[model samples]
Target: MEPTPTKETVELTTESGTLRRRGEWVVPRLLRIRSQAGAVRLDMSQARIAHPVVDIELSVLSGSIVLVLPDGATADLDRLHSPHASHRSRVPAVPTHQAPHFVLSGETYTGALRVRYARGHRRR
Candidate 1:
């Protein structure tokens, strides 16, 4: 029998200032953000997706939050509930009507939340 896949969780609990993660990395199943008066920025332009589904939960009271994904990544924001927050993206996200999906949830009290997609580079 095949083993069931377990979800991985990455948490960020900062009081002030900014937290940044960049370069080629692997994405976890769940990303939890809880900033009291700080900012968090994750650049996943060269990240590797091990699973088909990933979830990001943001809970920022103040400051700002940003998430950068690859060009072909798909995002599902139906569970996101941020009344006073803003989500910005220049290019259109690939529809999450298929297998692989990235779901974003949770809420922000008085911070700016943005999700953008950057085009990946081709190696020679």
Candidate 2:
């Protein structure tokens, strides 16, 4: 008999300074981030993701958050609530068939959220 694999949920929290997650890391099914006056940079370009869809929940109080996704991966920021923040994205909002999808939902006050593909990777 084969055993079923369990999905993982990762959480990152910071009060100040910078939080960066890059290089080759295992991506979870759900990623939650909370920051206060801190900068966050998540580069999932060389990550190992086992799920088809990943959810990211963020809460920022006065800082910036940057996300660098892998090629062919799409991000959906329609559920994010950033009334006093700026958002910039170079990736597609809708995911392609069988492609990895990231759904972002969170609130930011006086901060910014930027999403883009890895360097040299164009939107498909």
The best candidate by TM-score is: 2
Candidate 1 displacement at residue 124 in angstroms:
22
Q: Write the per-residue lDDT of candidate 1 for residues 61-121, one digit (tens) a residue.
A: 8888878776556676667777777776543445554434677888877778777675453
**RMSD over all Cα atoms, model 1:** 4.7
Per-candidate RMSD vs. true structure? 4.7, 2.8
Using lDDT as the measure, the top candidate is 2
Model 1 misplaced regions, further than 4 Å:
1-7, 91-100, 119-124
**TM-scores of all models?**
0.78, 0.91
Alpha carbon lDDT of residue 67, candidate 1? 80
Instruction: Return the lDDT, model 1, position 21.
Output: 85
Question: Per the 3 Å backbone cut-off, how many clashing residue pairs does candidate 2 have?
Answer: 0
- Tell me the whole-model lDDT of each prediction, alpha carbons only: 0.73, 0.89
